[model samples]
Target: MNTGRVVLITGTSSGIGLAAAVQAAQAGYTVVATMRDTTRSDALLKAAAEAGVTVDVRRLDVTDPESVAACVTAVADSYGRLDALVNNAGRANTFATIETCDLATYREVIEVNFLGVVAVTRAGLPHLRAAGGRIVTVGSTRGLIGQPFNEGYSAAKFAVEGFMESLAPTAAGMGVRVVMVEPGPVFETAFGANSGLTRESLLTEAGPYRRVLEPYLDWVARGAHPGAQTGREIAEHIVTALTDPEPPFRVLTSDWAREYTAIKYTDPEGGRVRAMTASWLAREED
Candidate 1:
């Protein structure tokens, strides 16, 4: 968790991945920054150089299982061990309705966000167990509650959280840890633009789903933006988790995130959530 620790991070080209890698390097971790194309990671490389740390930049498309396996193998071979794996590579889908959106759109989102973590974590397990390290997966507040226009993205994150909740207990037994970093909408990143590549029709004419679409995007734009923590601020939180005397199982980014998690747990089940989102099912009401 500190400097000299060997950490591997996915999607280091921009946004949270970029910020986290820089901060982790500054914290003294020998960072391995992976992207779809390392040749284009010029900015991230420059940032690390400026910070006086050398990051092992490599090309790793997480969606490709072969790439994931190879990169992780390279990590183990070069470092002899890995202390942490940060699965911060993900994209959002801002469609008007699931009906109109093609299956390809949903697949694209899930492949990169959900399955990518599974692939990478599975590959990194042996090295991590040998080092008794940690796994940090980036999640969203959207994973907690169904937002309006971004169902696909939310679903993907929801799946990730579910997977980690199960994986954490097993990891703890082995002296390894699994932690989820849940952040609210932070304006510092370029998620929307990159998401546009996979999911289009987000800001189009209000469809039948206009009610859900407008309010959610507005809330995301206005409410979340003003209180959006700096990329550096979020980075520091990770540093705390890595070095804490007793790090939390999950680190929530905002007061709202904490309150919402409290509500979900305090309710015995997600009763409040299902009741509010009437269309959603109360399949696991406790």
Candidate 2:
């Protein structure tokens, strides 16, 4: 039990972040569970209570620099050290082609998904360095292989992937480990609902892209595939990455995720990935 070890997690109002907070506390780490609004923290608190674990719930808006800095500072001041940081706060983009997406929409996704990670990590690095800590990010398979209509989200996650991959070796040299946990389709999460996209809405907005969007939506509604996981399942992977003696740089949540991402690793030329994703948007007659 890591009684004195402290870990800060963002976006704990629901889903993966909430699960991670509860599990981390159960693992005996002092968990600081944060969300944009403290008013939304009932779920996290209740879960922690039910599990007979205590979590220090705080308000942290990752997109705001002041909020990020203040939260990290407070945690360090109160705990004297930070052992780990989980970059889990993210916003999903609506299902739309790049051409159809407005610039503001793209910016919103980037702000919360990519830059939010940057701000929090930057603020926590000093304390983390002192503790020789770790940073675990919740990434998606979309970051490895872009989807047809999720350009904004995929782009943001891809930026995160590049930034973390480049920072890993240098961080390791500093006695800090950085890991990315990649999950495929996650079930029982607010992630999909937060996107604010529905079948009718997407079809109405598809306009010129309807021909392609239809098949894409059809493929999505076909129900869960082997690669789909629950919030708890992904959270388990996050906790394992945090606790493992020598975790890999990239941790895929399930066997299906490993196989799915293996396509990208093997296809350096990008042909196989393109073919596979394209099949999801294929026309009925094709």
Candidate 3:
């Protein structure tokens, strides 16, 4: 048990962040769960109560530098030390090819998914180093291989993977663990709804790409891959990463995600993942 060790997690209003907070608290970690708005905290509070553990919920808009600095300052003032930080706040762009994606859309996703992690980590590094703590950021399988219409989101995650890979070695020198937990197509979360990237809203009006996008969206709508993990399962893997003495630099949360990402990284040719994913879309279209 990490009794009294403080862990600050972003995006705890729902999904993986909420579960991670509840689970970490139950495991004896003092949890600080922050979301953009506190009004959405009801579900997290309820889950903490049900788990018989307490979580300190606060408002933190990760995209805003002021909010990030103020939240970190408040945490430092209150707890004086932070043992771990879970950078889970992310924004996904609606489906669009690179050519069609607006610059503002790309910036929005990068602001939350990439820069947000950097901001939070920078603010928490001193305290984390003091405790030899961990930094776990929730990335995506898309970080390994880009999907056709997910350019903005995928690019942000890829940047996160690159940034963390660069920072991991330096963080190790400071006795701090920096890791990325990559998950694929998680279910039981309003991520699509919350991210403002629902398939219907994006693909229904795909225009020129409708022929290819519709099939992919239909397959997803039909739930072709039933092995998608729940938020709690992903959170459990995150907790393991946090507690393990020597955790991996990157954690693929599901067997499926691991297998698929392996195809991209293990193959030096770098064509296998593209071919395989393209086949899925082609088959669906057919």
Candidate 4:
């Protein structure tokens, strides 16, 4: 139990944000779980009830500046201090290549993922500075690589990574720490369901696949199940990031992803496969 620690998480209607809120409340934190609408958060309310933990459900639309500011004000005014903030309200836009993407989709993605983060972080900076707390932004491995299909999602995440890196020094000066959790594919969640993909780019009037690729859609649908990390695991990690003396600035949740990153780090892009090919020779040298 976290002994009534005060925290806030955006996008609490479902997926990672919902789970994180439940877990935090269970851990004895007084959580302010903000969805776009509180009246519609039946699942969250029911789950919280079952767990016997009380979490305040508020309304927050990250894309709207007024909504973002209001949520921050509500938290600070009501709680008098905020211990931590988990900016988990985000989306992934698949099948949107740069050459063919709708400008509207790109704007929506950047507004919510990049600008929304800035709005909320700036609003909370005062209280976070007072509490000397931590900030956790859910990033993606795609943020590191240039995946062709997820251009919009990748670009937004890349911007987030850059923004976080730039703010790290200033945040540290205020005794506020920032961490980015880079997770690989997860098993279950509303992510795929809520993923704002459309036929604009994937099914253009002209091009290779004049129709959207059904097979690719099928693969993505099956891959993003929520069981990969239960609502509890994310909560535990969030707690660790808040309290751990030497919390990782970047935590990659997948084992293979870690191994892959390690390989990429040790050997240049073209050198990893060859390095892995001769394990015995490397071992002999060691």
* All candidates: TM-score: 0.87, 0.98, 0.94, 0.83
How would you encode candidate 2's per-residue C-alpha lDDT over 124-225 as one tens digit per residue? Answer: 889889999999999899899899899999999999999999999989999999999999999999978977778999899889999999998898888736
Provide the overall lDDT of each model, using Cα atoms, as 2-decimal numbers: 0.78, 0.93, 0.86, 0.74
Relative to the unseen true structure, what is the C-alpha lDDT of residue 76 in candidate 1, on a scale of 0 to 100? 87
Q: List the residue pairs that clash in candidate 4.
A: 2-27, 187-224, 187-225, 187-226, 188-225, 188-226
How much is the lDDT of residue 237 in candidate 2?
94
lDDT of each residue in 1-286, candidate 1, tens digit only: 4555799998888878888889888888889999998777988888888987778899899899899999999988998889999898886664546875778878888898899999999999998999989998888877877765567888898999999999999988998888888887666676666655431245455456555555555544456444467666677777667666667888997786687666666776767876655432122231
Off by over 4 Å in 2: none
lDDT of 4: 0.74
Ranking by lDDT: 2, 3, 1, 4
Q: Choose the strongest candidate by TM-score.
A: 2
- Which order, best to worst by TM-score? 2, 3, 1, 4
Which residue segments of model 1 deviate by more than 4 Å? 1-3, 197-206, 224-226, 268-286
Cα TM-score of candidate 4: 0.83
Alpha-carbon runs more than 4 Å astray in model 3: 196-200, 283-286
Better of 2 and 4 by TM-score: 2
Worst 10 residues of 4 by lDDT: 276-285
Kindly provide the TM-score of model 2 when superposed on the true structure, using C-alpha atoms.
Answer: 0.98
Better of 1 and 2 by TM-score: 2
Q: Is candidate 2 or candidate 4 better by lDDT?
A: 2
